[model samples]
Target: MSKIDSAERARALDLVPVSRETAERLDVIVALLEKWQRTINLVAPATLPQLWTRHVADSLQLVPLAGQVTRWVDLGSGGGFPGLVVAAALAEIPAADVTLVESDSRKAAFLREAARVAELPVTVVPARIEQVAAQLAPGVEVVSARALAPLSRLIELAHPFLAKGAVGLFLKGQDVDNELTESAKSWRISSRIAPSLTDRSGRILIVTSAVPLAPIKEAAGNAKGSTHD
Candidate 1:
């Protein structure tokens, strides 16, 4: 098995250079994940040895993709992948905030503790994504999810935040092409996909706009003299 030694891990961390304060906060989160993983399965057992590469580095790659956005909402934040990790980076930005929505009570509790211990600019919302999106305060700049749902459902789930002008940034597996095809069946969306730095089989999906195909078709049909060739 390939292994990443301390030197290698340090070099890997260099790929995304965070402020010293952000690094300290991430350290706290890593410690918490390790402690909690012993009993709660915060991460896959097979990946315990590669925690930094598999989780931390993977999450950190999303920061630059979000540009200058300061407010964020992470859906189904099971172990606070990009949410808490991103929050660590956001700590350096003024007025930054990251809200992590997790439905699992145990996971939510862990997320709360991690944020508290790390002292990150994060809010742990212990509720289903459906229940909290509408209640979210305005001006949220981005919404993200990891290993949560397919592209079609993700659009549905993130609709509230998107409607309010928040961009969507989702971490996805290699099957993303299939998911995007499925989503296109029902929705008209303007989006872009980027390769993931952490894993060859992973992808980053950024969605700026999503509208239902039904309405779009109706609008096209309603336009006077606008006929297909």
Candidate 2:
């Protein structure tokens, strides 16, 4: 891997400042990611040069939005972007933990190693989202995803947790407006959109309530074909 520019790293830290301990932990994660990238595809090749600003800072920006919530679930935690970074920041807080859900075995292994090496409080769940969503939903305070799926599909995957009152913080790009419009068709979502601190075109979607809208055809059929006494 090529060397990261010191200036870029400085800029990212400036955007989301952290204590020395947290910075060191994040450094370990970045180093481990670079080492593992040679064997497995951890992140996009083009983004490596700006990894700190693009990935690290982008992930770190979610920490503050989370407030004091300690128990977090990061869905599709590929390369541990916001998951590991959030865990690293919360490592010192009491009872603070982040669960990284990644189905790919190799990536899961990397997440485990990164958490172990950084001594961050994290659980690496190596199962598909649907397989473990129920088991992990209870007691979760925050649910997050970065570049995972469309807002509509994401709601489906995160429904179990959202229904349980866990807030959803999803990182989206320029097309977020379109995704929200698409998601509205099947879900009544109470959400707020915040501009991302790291990218000009990026946005962070905060969803507090997501209720599934009954299929129009199903409702129509029930109204026309069924009668109750």
Candidate 3:
């Protein structure tokens, strides 16, 4: 637990630093992602240079917001973004745990390896968001998602977890205004949008509720990949 400077310490938010011990593990994750992506195409290659900020820092930024979150579920954890970063930072917080859910097998494998090398208490579930109906742990306090879908779809994908009493934290882009407008038509959830630490145009949505569409309508929407994915 080396003492980081004020700014860097602020970044950890009373948690742990992603320093030497953690860096080695994170490096392993990065290396593996870069390697597998050549064939599987996980993350956008052009974004590699900002991986530390766009992905890692973006996820880690949440640590300070919820200073003592013990458990979290990350939906659509493609390429491990905030999910792996959250797990790695939480690895330093006693009793902290995270679950990373990804539909892609290659991404799931990367998440598993990241957890192993980082020695973080994280579970990776390789399944589509809709397939895994919301049985999150009863006491899970936080639920996060990154680059998954529109705000409306995110609320639907998170319906299960939100119903189970988890607060939703989703990373969205500048077009949030348009998405929010469209999402309002189908679901009703109270949310606050905040600026993202990594991307100037990105927004972090903090939500508390999500009303579901009727089963008949939901089923119809699913057929078109519009309800949840």
Candidate 4:
């Protein structure tokens, strides 16, 4: 395989300030991501070159929003965005853990390897989101997803986690208002959208409460229809 430019990757990581240890782990994960992308299509082809800023930084921004809490559940952790990234940060905390749920076997394998390479404390669940939410939700303090599904759908899959008192931190692009509007009609939700540090067009959704106000019958079937993990 051709060599990935470490200098360039480090420059991209400079966008977000991290501890030296976390920086080393992220650097390693970047190289591993580039290596895995060659075979499994871990992330989008267009975004691969900017993984540090576009994915890593964007994912890392969620850590502060969640305070000192640990125990996270990242659904559809395809490329291990905020999930594994957060795990690397929480590795120093004795009680910290991030459970990555990915149904795709190949992606799950990549996630497992990435965590091992970074030595982050992550539990890779090679199963669908619905299968594990029931067993994992109650103890979780945070639940996250990125480009996993639409806003309405995200709320549905995260319900189990939120209902169990976990905070939801989801990375969403510009259409967030529309998604929130659509979601409000079916579910009574308590959420806040914050600016993303990595991208001007992106938003970080912090959801605290969600209750079913009504059922959606159309395309997505009230969020439950689309469970990415």
Best by lDDT, which number?
Answer: 2
lDDT comparison, 1 vs 2, better candidate = 2
Error (Å) of candidate 4 at residue 212 is 0.7
Sequence-dependent TM-score of model 2? 0.92
Cα RMSD for candidates in order = 9.1, 8.8, 6.0, 3.3
Ranking by TM-score: 2, 4, 1, 3
Candidate 1 residue spans exceeding 4 A from truth: 1-8, 214-229
CA lDDT, every prediction? 0.78, 0.85, 0.69, 0.81
Error of 4 at 137 (Å): 0.3
lDDT of 4 by residue, 1-229 (tens): 5344445456556766788898888877878878887888777777666677777878888888999987998988887886888898788888888999888888889889999989999999988776678789988999999888888778878888999999999999889999999988889889999998878899999999999886633343222211221
Tell me the lDDT of candidate 2.
0.85
Cα lDDT of model 1 overall? 0.78
| lDDT digits (tens) for residues 1-229 of candidate 1 | 3232344356448877777888888878877877887678676677766767777888898989999988999888877787889998888888998998877788889989998888888888877666678888378999988777667777877887888889998888899888988999998888999998878999999999888776422111111100000
Among the numbered candidates, top TM-score falls to 2
**Quick one: RMSD of model 4?**
3.3
- Give the CA lDDT, 0 to 100, for residue 175 in model 4: 90
